[model samples]
Target: MKPKTYFLCTVVFLASVAADASLSLAFDKAKLDTFLTTNACKYCDLSEADLSGRELRGADLENAKLGSVKLSGADLSALPMEKRTKRTNLESANLRGADLTNANLANAAASGAYLREADLTGADLSGADLSSANLKDANLTDAKLDGAKLDGAKFCGTVMPDGSKNDEGCAP
Candidate 1:
């Protein structure tokens, strides 16, 4: 890991430990509102939020913490061809243990993202950039992942896009 990333993770862990027990794991209401209104929330903490079935295509969420967030059936895919500017940026975002069942994440830029143990059953992740992402133990049954960038991605115990179990990146 990069030094910066390591530092950030350490800081976040320390902060979570130092904070009050109740508020540390909750999503920030103000940040959530900002993201809902603007569709852009870099480095925001949206973890543990219930955002199922929301229209969030092309949202810019780089480095955001979405761990344990309920995004089942949400649309976080690419925008239409004519009206498009950029793809959804999930780079380095934390999506660990998220519920993304049937979510549309097609063509999103998710390089270096963390998605450990996420439930992604039937999610559409076609053409997305997943380079160096950690998908350990993630469930991708029936997911559409054609043309996705899988370079350097970790997939230990991951349920593949084709509904197969993959232990390619597992450690002994």
Candidate 2:
């Protein structure tokens, strides 16, 4: 092989390696532990963190900031009624494809959050504010939405709490 050609191939390989490195984002376990122990991490920068497929049941994240955080396939279910206190605050967070089965999100503020294809089965969202949030293709089977805000929320192909599908908010 020619020297010039070899140099070109090496440059291309290096560039690809750099791109892959930049694309990889890891979850911050220390930050998660801090939030869990203290029960307070308001405005904490956890953007673009990967927390997929983890069990974070009964986490109290009220008023915490989790913008652009990746929690796909994670279990965020709430604690039992006897051990319940404040609801988790996921306001304006990117929770696309996350699992929140049986989570007690009563009075939680999740306005304008991205929850596309998320599983919220049996979650209690009573009095919660989900206005303008994306719920496209999300499953809400048996989830409680009594007095919950849904004004301007996207529900295209979304499953309702009563096990019915709704496409009222879908755009043609």
Candidate 3:
């Protein structure tokens, strides 16, 4: 009821809010790391988290938001290529040594993502946007590219899904 008491209560409330926010951030970070290490968070909210070198084999990550997250060297082979939307959002994310065989990535956005030495065999990339993605030494054997956009997508020693080389403007 007193003015001094009210002021002290307000300060305490503000300090508590700040502390709560910090704690929440810390907890989210810790949880993310734990999930990556243990491979527990299959369908969790991993939006905007750093997941480089994570082993997500056979994980159910359907409809997961990974906008602007770093997933360099993350093993995504565990995902079932058929009957699933392995269509990940890896814009500017590192994808070295990743396996994306037979994945349905139709209409996915992967501009500027590093995909050196990655495998994309039999993947359905129809109508997908792969601008500026590094395909150095990557395999795309038998992958679908019908109506797909490949503006500036590098193809250094890349293998097409149809057992052919992926030169610029080559249609199946």
Candidate 4:
């Protein structure tokens, strides 16, 4: 191979290796598992990972950074049915079609996130920040949304299941 070609290839390889190393150092499955099992819901960083179609019931991920993560079709119904709550920093995360029935997400920051077709039946979302979120075709039956922020959020074709549109805290 030419010297120039070899040098370019080496640089690319090193850059890829460095990126992988950084990702591995940042997120580890064993540590996440330990935190999940213990329900220690606070300050977990799970950014830019593929968690699509996984079961994460009762996982304490409060304040976790889940930006650019693919959680499409994941089942999040393992949270407490009565006190259903969220503690994660899901800003700009993709959660399309995820089941979050009876989940409590009071004060959760879900701004600019993609939640199209996600199920959030009877969920508590008081004081949650859902600005600029895509909630197309999402189910929010009997969900509580007192004091929630939906500024610039898209709710195209979203169903309430009970046939009631969300008027509480919605800005016109």
Among these predicted structures, which one has the highest TM-score?
1
Which portions of model 3 miss their true places by more than 4 Å? 1-88, 167-172
Q: What is the per-residue lDDT of model 2 for residues 100-125, given as tens digits with 9 covering 90 to 100?
A: 66666667677787888878888778
What lDDT would each prediction earn against the true structure? 0.93, 0.71, 0.64, 0.65
Candidate 1 lowest-lDDT run of ten: 16-25
In the range 66-168, model 3's lDDT, one tens digit per residue, is 3334444555442446677554455665656656666666666667777777777776678667898888778888878887788999886788767877665
Candidate 4 lDDT over 1-172, as tens digits, reads 9999999999999999999899764455665566557744355555555565665654545445554444544544334466665444556756566566666666767777777777777776677788988887778887777887989888766776576664433445
What TM-score fits each model?
0.83, 0.63, 0.49, 0.51
Collision pairs in model 1: none
Sort the predicted structures by lDDT, highest score first.
Answer: 1, 2, 4, 3
lDDT at position 162, candidate 4: 73
After superposition, candidate 2 runs with Cα above 4 Å error: 1-25, 42-87
Residue-level lDDT for 49 in candidate 2: 64
Candidate 1's error at 115, in angstroms?
0.5
Question: How many clashes would you count in candidate 3?
Answer: 9
For candidate 1, the per-residue lDDT at 166 reads 96
Clashes of each: 0, 0, 9, 5
